[model samples]
Target: MDGLFLLSSYAVKDAILIRPFSLADIQSVMEIQSACYPANLLEEAEHLIAKHQQSPLSCWVATEHQKAIAYLLTHPWSGDTPPALNTPLPPKKPKSDIYFIHDLAVLPSARGLGLAKRLFDTAIDWAKQEKLQKIRLIAIAGAADFWIKQGLSPVNDKTLSHKLDDYGSDTHYLEAAI
Candidate 1:
């Protein structure tokens, strides 16, 4: 968090905007993901593109001065199982009561600018707008605390423990009411 611009004077707080992702923004999206996550955990481009292509309205990018600095990917899911990372979503949106957050990555330099909160708010607002019941995600990269602070709680269901295992040993399935 060293390079994070915490003060509003940086204007990153006021100037940041969130919009739908475009194919042209892929590289910047990938760069931000690379900076935020390890190589093995970073989502593949195919999966990212497919998610957006499937539910363009559910995927979004946060920008500063019109440059992509962060992104959030989400899709509908029917059951408790979260989709495997790096796997492409189906071409059509799934029928479901849950909105699964597939990814939320902000560059280290942009961490304190409130981009993550903005992207998170966007997801919550979208779910409400679409009449989805709740939001879900697999917490990784030691992000369980962050999600918990955002109002998501860890799933304690015995049945979900195995499906969540695919994410990693520390992976946590979290959900929040809409």
Candidate 2:
């Protein structure tokens, strides 16, 4: 559960395997990204790959029938402000007790099956295993409620608001203690 390759089987309508993401899963991840996010929010392959390369243990995919249906992208970070969208995380992030959840997406067809929560649990499990202090993420558009359900409260910080313009309006920065 702590490592990237640890797989969890969910007994949903269709059997889903929550497993580590690989470079080969990029296209399927993109399809899910397109289905879940707007053009401006969809991440490029290089950015996704960069995050995986930098922190493979923090990234994972939910696969059904050997195809990616959902994914969670996370990486260690040292700040309150999240990184820029559509860009690879810069090397040498400051040392801190937190990690940034860059993105989480599930295919429309896979909704209502609890795939989102399952993927989220994987990331949370990792955080707990690592003794991480916090989990930070941006709740884009209509995602605030879902994140709230996961125990993250909206963070009212000026640095985050000014830096998140590329993430569009209605984005809320949220964080929760692990």
Candidate 3:
């Protein structure tokens, strides 16, 4: 089968729902993560759910036909020391608010349907609504071009080395003003 022909029918026709994430959607989110990534991806879903439950501004999920297909988690960039792995993220600063997009994934079956862009647009809109000055994220290997096309620019400062050892080598830091 030709690759182009195989890729042309991947578009999702059902309505794409973008909304705040809740505990009820955790399992679906995890399933999408498992389908899209090589490694287990829900280690932080529980934490994200809890944080969102406490503060709805922190996370959002995108669904197609009532099934979670993509999700994004955002956290404030405080000046204090970064929290330990798995700890709840701190709140944003008042003067120069910044949101760090910790995770974003769209199921493989749902790729090329504009789901990722929708998720990104939702996050960027939220940040702007909150008067945030910047949105930052680390583009995993193979995702730099996608992010660049979305107006995210690579930052030369420190990288997310501790999260994934290979992150330093494969990931590029990116940020965009909202």
Candidate 4:
């Protein structure tokens, strides 16, 4: 974990190493995923790794005391639709205008540490640097309100809505300008 990026003043008023995710963080990421999501919603580690390999610049893990407590997985995407649950990102995808927030999770024990927002700020910073138009994500379960507080408005496209059937009964598509 040497050379990990440290974000000392993310306004959480505590030290947290928000570092680019290395392959070594996969197991920890999976553990956090399992703790945060239901079995049917958990993504395979391979799919998560492919995303990291594809966009290392935007993928990040947050550690406190050298233990990963949260992570943000993101990548460039067309923004036409959210990927289905457990699906691997397709190869040779077309050019992208949106930066997709594939996953953001913090362990229950780590909640209220402002870790999720710090991790999200990491992704937003990347999207701004890339000059992507907007940030997009499917807020599964009942997490839409948390995202709403982040300034992403709910998307209302019927075509896009139909495609998210596999995401779950409570999934919601949301987006925000960069």
Worst 10 residues of 3 by lDDT: 78-87
Could you give me the TM-score of model 3 versus the true structure? 0.76
Per-model clash counts, in order, read 0, 0, 0, 0
Which residue runs of candidate 3 sit more than 4 Å off their true CA positions? 1-14, 40-42, 80-87, 90-96, 158-168
lDDT of 2 by residue, 29-132 (tens): 88999999888888888888998998898899998877789999898888666888888687955566887888899888889889889989999999898788
Q: Write the per-residue lDDT of candidate 1 for residues 36-150, one digit (tens) a residue.
A: 8877787788878888777788889998888899999888777766777787665554568988888899899888888888899988888999999988899986889889989
Q: What are the TM-scores, per candidate, against the unseen true structure?
A: 0.86, 0.89, 0.76, 0.89
RMSD of each: 6.4, 4.6, 8.1, 3.9
Off by over 4 Å in 2: 1-14
The residue-by-residue lDDT of candidate 3 on 1-178, one tens digit each, is 7876654444344367787887888888778767765563334775666556544776888877677888876666744223343456555355646677777888888888897888888888877787878777767758889989999997654544464443435666777878
Alpha-carbon error at 24 in model 3, in Å?
0.4
Clashes, model 1: 0
Candidate 4 lDDT tens digits, 1-178: 3334334344245557798999999999999999999888888999999998888899999998778999999999884767776877877366788899999999999999899899998889889988999888999889899999999998888888777877789989999999
Lowest summed lDDT window (length 10), candidate 4: 2-11
User: Which pairs clash in model 4?
Assistant: none
Off by over 4 Å in 1: 1-13, 91-94
Query: lDDT score, residue 62, model 2?
Result: 94
